[model samples]
Target: MSTLSKIEPTDATEPVAEVLAEVKKALGAVPNMAKTMAHSPALVRGWLALSGALSVGVIPAPVREQLALATAEYNDCEYCLSAHSFIGSKVAKLDPDEIERARHADSADPHAAALLALSDAIARGRGIVEDAALETARAAGVTDAEIAEVVGNLALNILTNYFNILADTDNEFPPVTPLAHA
Candidate 1:
């Protein structure tokens, strides 16, 4: 059971209902995470705005999904892990091996590996990232714009992860392998 009752689209009010409509249109359904967030209409709005901005940012969709997966795994959030895994595979077309590697913040692509390492560092370091980590990302051809996008993506995913943990939101998407810590 969830710690809070999810506000379903049918029961949502005003702004929440409007946002839920858009979410459903974009995602094919209102994910439980979004529904749980609808408990606070402002949060759902803010999340939608941030998510929309990040969708067109410099980072490619696959890398963004990879970062999300890595952040979810690091945070031990089952809801986010499952959600991102589904989107990462079906929408982003990431291979099973890529998704598995992403969970550990490792990737076969050099540039992606560096960004994934930085994503893990940001989560583990609590935003007190070391200079060497930044340098590594730069050396791997991650530009300033890309770095900023990575940070944004990490923040976005972390918000969902923390929310899912607090809400204990029911999984509405296909389940992924459980994290060892979970």
Candidate 2:
């Protein structure tokens, strides 16, 4: 059971219903996170607005999902871990290894690897990363816009991760367990 009310599409009304429909239209399903967030229409709208903005960001969908996976693992949010794992592989077309590597904020591609490393630093440093982290990302071909988008994506993931953990949101996606990192 969730700490918060989990609104189902059938039970939703008015603003919540409209937003949930939009979510379903876009995603083909209303995820449990959105259903839980429907408890507050403002939260749903705020999340959608930010998410819509970031969809066109320089980070790309795969990398954005990678950051979300990394953030979910960092926070140990099972709901998000499972959800992103599904979205990462199914929607973003990332391979299983890439999805796993993302949890550790790693990637084989140098550009993605740099961003993931910066993501790891951001998570570990609590957003107070060292200068060299940014420098390294820049050196690896990350742009200023990419850095900004990474932070934006990180913030978005943290919002969902914390919300799901706080709400104890039931997992609506396939289960994914966290692995011990080296």
Candidate 3:
């Protein structure tokens, strides 16, 4: 059970209601995470702005989804792990094995592997990426613009991961396999 109450569209204030409508239109339904975020209209708006902008950014959708999966796994956020796994497979066309590899921040594609490494480094290093890591990403063909976008995507996923953990947000998407940490 979530500690925070989700703001339903019909019950939302003007600003929140508007944002919920947009979320509904885009996703075909209001995700639990978005609804939980709607508890604060400002948060919902800020989330939507950043997420909407990133959706059209340089990084392709699959890469973005993979990065999210890797971040969620590192952060140990069950809600995001489940949500992104579903989105990655269904919307981003990532296969099961690909999704598993993404959770480990490894990819078969050289370029994608580099980006995932950077994403993992950002999460593990708390955003203080080393010069060598940046060089690896650059050598893998990630441009300065793409690097910036990857950082943005990392931040975005971190926000949701932290939110879900803090709020104990219910999983609305298909369940993903739980991580086994030894």
Candidate 4:
């Protein structure tokens, strides 16, 4: 159970109802994160807009999922870890080993590994990654645009992770334990 109650689409009035509809359309079902965010129409709309925008960005789906997984683990947000774990496997077709490795911001691919390490540096350093880390990623072939996309994706995941942690949102996806994956 969440600290905040989940609002069902049917029970939502005007503005919120419309937002929830969009969420359902985008996700195929209304997950708890959206339901909780439905309390504020703007929050839900902003989240959806950013998510939609980033979906087509330069970063591929697999790496984006990796970013989500890495951030979720960093922030210790179980809801996000679980959600991304399921999405990473089902939607992004990440293998179990890949998924697990991503939780540590690691990948066998040098480019992905570099990006994940950069992400962790950004998170750990409070959005201020060292020049060396950026250089490392650049050396790994992560483009400036891809680096920018990483920040964007990190912001998107952090919003949900912080929101879910604060709201204690129920996990609708398969349960993923941070300790086990960590």
Model 2 quality (TM-score): 0.94
Alpha-carbon error at 41 in model 1, in Å? 1.3
Every candidate's CA RMSD? 1.4, 1.7, 1.5, 1.4
For model 1, where is the 10-residue window of minimal lDDT? 173-182
TM-score of each: 0.94, 0.94, 0.94, 0.96
Candidate 1 clash pair list: none
Give the CA lDDT, 0 to 100, for residue 142 in model 3.
Answer: 88
lDDT tens digits by residue: candidate 1, 1-182: 89988888988888889988888887688888889888787888788889889999888899889999998888888898998899999999999999999999999999999989988888788889999999998999989998788889888998999999999999988876557864
lDDT of 4 by residue, 1-182 (tens): 68999999889999989999999999999998999989999999999999999999998999999999999998989999999999999999999999999998999888899989998999899898789999889999989999898899989999999999999998989888886554
Error of 3 at 144 (Å): 0.6
Cα lDDT tens digits, model 3, 26-143, are 7799999999988777887787789889999998999899999999998888899999999999999999888999999999888889999998888788889899999999999989
List, residue by residue over 36-70, the lDDT tens digit for candidate 2. Answer: 99978889888988999999777789988899999
Candidate with top TM-score is 4
Instruction: Note the Cα lDDT for every prediction shown.
Output: 0.88, 0.89, 0.89, 0.92
Local error of candidate 4 at 39, Å?
Answer: 0.2
Please give the lDDT score at residue 32 for candidate 4. Answer: 89
Among residues 3 or more apart in sequence or in different chains, the pairs in candidate 2 whose N, CA or C atoms overlap within 3 Å are: none
Clashes of 3: 0
Superposed by TM-score, candidate 2 places the C-alpha of residue 158 at a distance from the truth, in angstroms, of: 0.1
